[model samples]
Target: MSLRRILKSWVERYFSDEEALILLLVLIAGFAAVIWFGRMLAPFFTALVIAFLLQGVVSALTRRGIPHLLSVIVVFLGFVGVLLALAFILLPLIWDQLIGLVQETPRMFASGQNWLDELQSRYPNLITPDQMQNWIGVASREISQLGQRALTLSLASLGNLLSLIIYLVLVPILVFFMLKDREALVGFTLSLLPQKRALMARIWREMDDQIANYIRGKFIEIIIVGTVSFITFSFFKLPYTALLAVLVGFSVLVPYIGAAVVTLPVAAVAGFQFGLSESFVYVLVAYGVIQALDGNVLAPVLFSETNNIHPVSVIVAVLFFGGIWGFWGVFFAIPLATLLKALVHAWPRGMKGRDERHHALASEESMEESL
Candidate 1:
């Protein structure tokens, strides 16, 4: 086929449908907004996400014979209560843990240097005096700079504190109004769009369910994993248990990579605190069990009916989105990947098949293989 013919064929095959065009434009606009005003509008976006998550609870309450306003109020209050608890109790505990961890750093380095020295003595050929001295020098410099960096970060955090306060105040207000006026908000948003939104509506319906399930499941996973980790670490008398638990909980946001990367800190803390004692082994085993159960059992149950994108697609989404949007990007990687998968599968082609759904499935499978 001629190049022009191939181009025409591809466009017709994938983009001839008006719905596909609309979807493409919407995605482009959404991405642009995120890239452009992501930091400036962080609170609004955060509020939107909280509203989305809480919508399910509000809906459930309404279904259980509660009035919508009452439901919104109840859910909003519950959310505020959690926020208050985090601010007053959890935040202070984590802050102390962070300070303790920082204070322990010098000792940790000393212990590490001792180990390196022992290794160098045992393997003279492998690690010479010059190399050992160089390593120690680098470590000392890092330790020295650590205090300076912490002070700088402390100053920087004051600015971040203002932003955080804005978020804490604004997010709840936005969420409350969003929940209370859900229909008005939806109607207003839909009113701004063109009258014909068949394709957009279909995509929204699919995305709404998937996104809701995914978000709720993730929140549950984080809470379960974090709480369990905190309990386990506390029981084992591990230092920085709260901080490490929070890290482990959030690590689930990145699937396989998260668990592995977070294991380093947990093991390091355990080793530093307890050396090779039985408590260290027990801590590691318990941590391993939490990860295993989360992956093997919890995730499967939670996401069984949600998007089923390949692991490769997931990792790519994490790298791509996380590169662009940083932490939140990595956090929402899977859902975003699933959204793309949905768009691809649902993109209308001019050609007709005996079974259209089956054809879409086949096309999606082909696309996945290419990816």
Candidate 2:
């Protein structure tokens, strides 16, 4: 076939209906809005996510014979309670531990430096003086940089306090109304779209349940992993237990990468406190067991309903979306990846279905003419 004919055939196969074209435009517009207005509407987005998380609880409560408004109210109050605990209780502990960790950095570095010195002396042939100097220089520079960044963060946080206040005031209101008026809000949103939305409906049906299950499962995993990590660290008498536990908990957000990255701090804290002793070994072994169980058992059970996405695809999605939207990107990486897969699967099915209908119509016309 000629290039023009090939192009025409491909377009006909892919974009045979206005639904396909409209969906493409909607996706492009949605992405552009996020890229442009995401930061400005962060509070809205955050509230939206919080509402999504709580909606499941509200639904469950309603299913259990509670009134819808009562369920929403109960769930909202619980959300507020959790937020208060984080803000007033858990946060303060984490913050204190973080500050303590920063203050203890110099002492940790000194111990590390002493260990390196002893290693150099014992392995003089293997550890050249130049290499030793280079290593020390690198460590010194890194510690210095960490201190500088911490200082900068402290200063920036003051400016962010106002922003935080806005979120505090606005987010709850938005979340409450969102829950209370969810059906109306959804109806309004749907009204904005074309009446003929069979393809869109198909994609939404798949994504809505999939994304909800993924988010709920993920939060549960984070809580379970983080709580377990905290208990384990406390058992080992590890310093900065709260801080390290928070890291370990949030690390579940990035799948393989999160666990690996958090391990450094856990091991460093263990090694610093107990050196090459059995305590350090035990802590490390315990951490390994936690990770193994999480990956092999907890994750599978929680995410059984989610699509069987490839590991490489998951990693790539994390990197891609994380680069695009940072924390939220990383947070929603898997769901976003699932959405992409849904779109890919949905669009082809839509086109083929439309093609079949068109052929059927043509055949009917031929039969009528023959009659």
Candidate 3:
């Protein structure tokens, strides 16, 4: 084919499917809106996500003969209870530990400096004493700056306490109504669309199930892994158990990267507390077992092969969406990537010609039947 014909064919091949075009346009618009107004719409998005996560629970309760409204109310109350517990109970404990750690910062720095000095003594040519001292100086200065920045940010957050309160109030209300009026919302959304929406419907159904399962699975995984880590660390008398446990728990979210990155803190805490003793070895072994069980047992039980996405793809999705939406993006990267994959597979190829012929045949058949 000529270059012009080739260009025309390519454009027609991709754009000829009206439903595909519509889906693409809608995705682009939605993405643009999020990028433009992410902060302003964060609460609504968060509420929507919470509603989606709780939907299965609501359905389960309704199936057990509870009324739909009652199910929603129960779930909403349970959610609020959990949030209150975290805010008042769990957070205070974590914060106290954090303050303790900060107060012990000088000891940590001294220990680190001693280790560096030992290294310099062993390998005099590799790391000079002056270089070690300079490195320590830089790190100390950086830590000071970091502490100041953290305090400043905390103060800033306090200033935005009203905004946080608004979110706390508004989100639950949105989630409650969303769960209660889900069918009506779905119907109203569908009513705005064209009648011919088979492809869109199929894609929507697939994405709905995939996203829901993924979110629920991750939630369970975090709780299980974090609890296990906390118990294991506590048994070993490790300091900062809560902080480390939280890291280890959420680390499961990023697959390979999360575990590897979180290992550092666990190791550092263990080494600092017990040096090369058997307690350190025991702590490491316990952590290894936890990770192994999480990967082999808990994950298989909770998540299915539906998340059979390639490792490379998962990493790329992490980078891409994480860049766009930070933590939330990283949290949702895999499911979002799966949605894109489904869309690509579902998009019709050579649809224009097929649709035209099918409509023509239907028109002729109708006329003959009328006659």
Highest TM-score: give the candidate number. Answer: 2
Task: Compare candidates 1 and 2 on TM-score and give the better one.
Answer: 2
lDDT of 1 by residue, 1-371 (tens): 89999999998887766656776887899899999999989888888888878999999999999999999999999999999999899999988888888889989988878878888889999999999999999989987898888888888998878877988899999899999998999999898777766667777888888888898899999999999999999898888988999999999999889999999889889988887679889989999999999999999999898977888888899999899999889978888888887776666666552147456668989999999
**Candidate 1 off by > 4 Å:** 122-148, 351-371
Clashing pairs in 3: none
How close to the true structure is residue 141 of candidate 3, measured as C-alpha lDDT?
Answer: 100
- Ranking under TM-score, best-scoring first? 2, 1, 3
Ranking by lDDT: 2, 1, 3
In candidate 1, the residue pairs with backbone N, CA or C atoms under 3 Å apart (3 or more residues apart, or in different chains) clash, namely: none
lDDT agreement with native, every candidate: 0.87, 0.91, 0.87
Tell me the TM-score of each prediction against the true structure. Answer: 0.90, 0.93, 0.89
Cα-based lDDT at residue 305, candidate 2: 91
Worst 10 residues of 1 by lDDT: 351-360
Residue 135, candidate 2: alpha-carbon lDDT: 91
Candidate 2 or 3, higher TM-score?
2
